[model samples]
Target: MKRFFAKKEITAILFIGILFTLSFFNWRSAYATMKEHTVSYLASAGNKWENLSSFIMDVDNTIHEQVYQKYYYIEGYGYIQELLGKKEINNFEVVKAKDGTLHYTYFTSGPNQVTSLVERMERLKKAATKVGSEVIYVMTPDKYVTGVTEFDKGIPYNYANETADNFLQELEKKEIDTIDFRKLMKEEKEFAPDSFYVSDHHWKVETAFWAFTKFVEVLEDNYGLVFPNKGEYTNLENYNQIVYEDSYIGSMGRKEGKLYSKVEDFTFIYPKFETNFYYYAQNGSRDVKAEGRFEQSLAFTSLLSGKGNIYDATNDKYFTYMNGNPGFVEVNNFNEPDAPKVLFIKDSLMVPVASFFALGCSKVYMIDPRYYSGNIEEVIDEYQFDYIFVSYTPQNLTEEFFPFYKE
Candidate 1:
């Protein structure tokens, strides 16, 4: 009789606890989504009568998205992964390397098809030639470094390097001048594990600066061009290094959270020398213009201004370069009148790379095809750039990047 009474009492306490927890979540989700839900509900009122089940699902999804403390919930999931000793997170969408770096990857056995992609590049070449500008396919290195990065058993490899090799070979056959940073980085003894962030897919700003130095070398040797301040532009010591520890949670970090992977430190590198720049960017109706000094003009330092422990999704610190790949952005270096005028059709990897132009370029225009609403060919003709660089990482060898040249 005594044991039966104790069991009943324990069951009653657990039941009440579960009910209270459910009620708390229900109230939060309701309060959080009340306005949006009401608007959406009215928008779908007619559809609700026609396809009642479908309308019900829309409500369900809205509720699902509005879970209170969503970030904490994902963090809890990351903690669970740590407790389980799982190297792969969210079913292999992200994998942890031996060094604890997060990588975006999917299962692949061999190289990806790039014949059509090469054709797109060939078209880009034609466009550049039509505008009297020389073009080069600048291949940015993927985050997954060969030999240096390793995954545990059962972790899926993305085979991005092999894909890159095939794509470059195709470009070479077409006589397309190319710069493969993967090969360049491999040859550099200093391009070791430390050159990358531990928890982000993007390379460090220092690495991007190193790339800028090498790119200048290419121009001087191949294009018969000489930089005005060659010594000042290439040297890393001339740049101001601002570092904030425990400051960043990268794209992958936001997915896996701090428990599965540690929060990464962010570093900002800018010219220590006095300089003047005029920058303008446009994305839809959002237009931003900055002038006077590199730090104030080119760099969007507002993203780094954090209000405490909580990270805002809108403020992705990595995009502090040129305000994060707007549809169109132009930079005019008031100091470098004789500097080469260059244009870049590039991805996010080239955002920081374009900023390096502030050191010497007279004019620089960048267009991200994914966002730009203007015609690429028109931009090329009007600008008449001295050099046009079409740069994309190996992983981005897809229909998305080659959207410029379509029948």
Candidate 2:
């Protein structure tokens, strides 16, 4: 009888404990706190769980005075990887060079899916011919090809270079007017040693501007078009160049942390003159007008401002160029309304370049096909562009295809 009573008492205590624990969790999740009222109400169950987990992890993190999630990563997977002497973290492979530079793994594969691309371009070219608009293709090289020459053995398989070369040749055979920027970057690298970042994949501001100059040169030569004098670009005094020291910790640095890799410098280039422009975002039912800037537009500037945290998405120095890519952005330059209207169908690599064109041209219609959901032929019909430039970095080419007919 005594043993039976003891067992019942123990079972009752355990049940009460579980109930208390569950009650506390329910209260914590449903608490009408500021964060809950503002943000948590909109969160999905998965995000709520993540927030709960983050809160629990923050206890130890607070004790150590570290970022909430960094404590767990550093003390958990990082510890295990160090113990095993491994350099790769997830899909990113961290490589160290003799000069203490960091490089990530790169692979080159066969050509991109160009069947849809060719068909779409042909159709667009046909429509463009009705309006007397010409299509131009520009290829931007990968960082592995333009910047880092030294790498760990068997890393960054040299397939991208071959694929880009082959694609350029194919475009030529098809009689498509293409600009192989690899040749331009190779020549620019001779003078601008820091044309590409050691830690990041994007080119430096100097290199981007150089390519823009080359773009004009090609346009003038091939299309018999007049261009601005080279002195406007050749002189650094024409533009304002701001250098933010140690402000960049590229995508590679973010993965491995500052202890493992070196940070890079970022430069912001803006036009010195006061410019007048109008920006329009035409996303299906969302036709909105945005005031333009040499950098980010006025409407979305505050949303993208500030010195973001090391890992924060908006804090990236590259965004100062044109506030990154929006689906469909149109710009009208009041500075020169009579200048030729150009349509740029490109990747994010053309962000800064696109801004430059917007500054010079009377009208510029920028389309990023990857994110765009509108009819391309209709846009060409509406704009009646003088030139259509197709620009993509080598690595991005494989990922983006032209969606010509389908929105």
Candidate that would win on TM-score:
1
Best by lDDT: 1
Candidate 2, superposed: residue stretches over 4 Å from native: 1-87, 92-116, 146-148, 156-158, 190-193, 228-230, 282-306, 405-407
lDDT, model 1: 0.83
Clashing pairs in 1: none
TM-score of 2: 0.74
Tens digits of per-residue lDDT for model 1 on 216-303?
A: 8877898766677989988889999999778888778888688888877888998998889999999976899999889899998887
Count of backbone collisions within predicted model 2:
2
Superposition error at 101 for model 1 (Å): 1.6
lDDT of 2 by residue, 322-368 (tens): 45666788888776788888888887667777777565687788787
Q: Model 1: C-alpha RMSD to truth?
A: 4.2
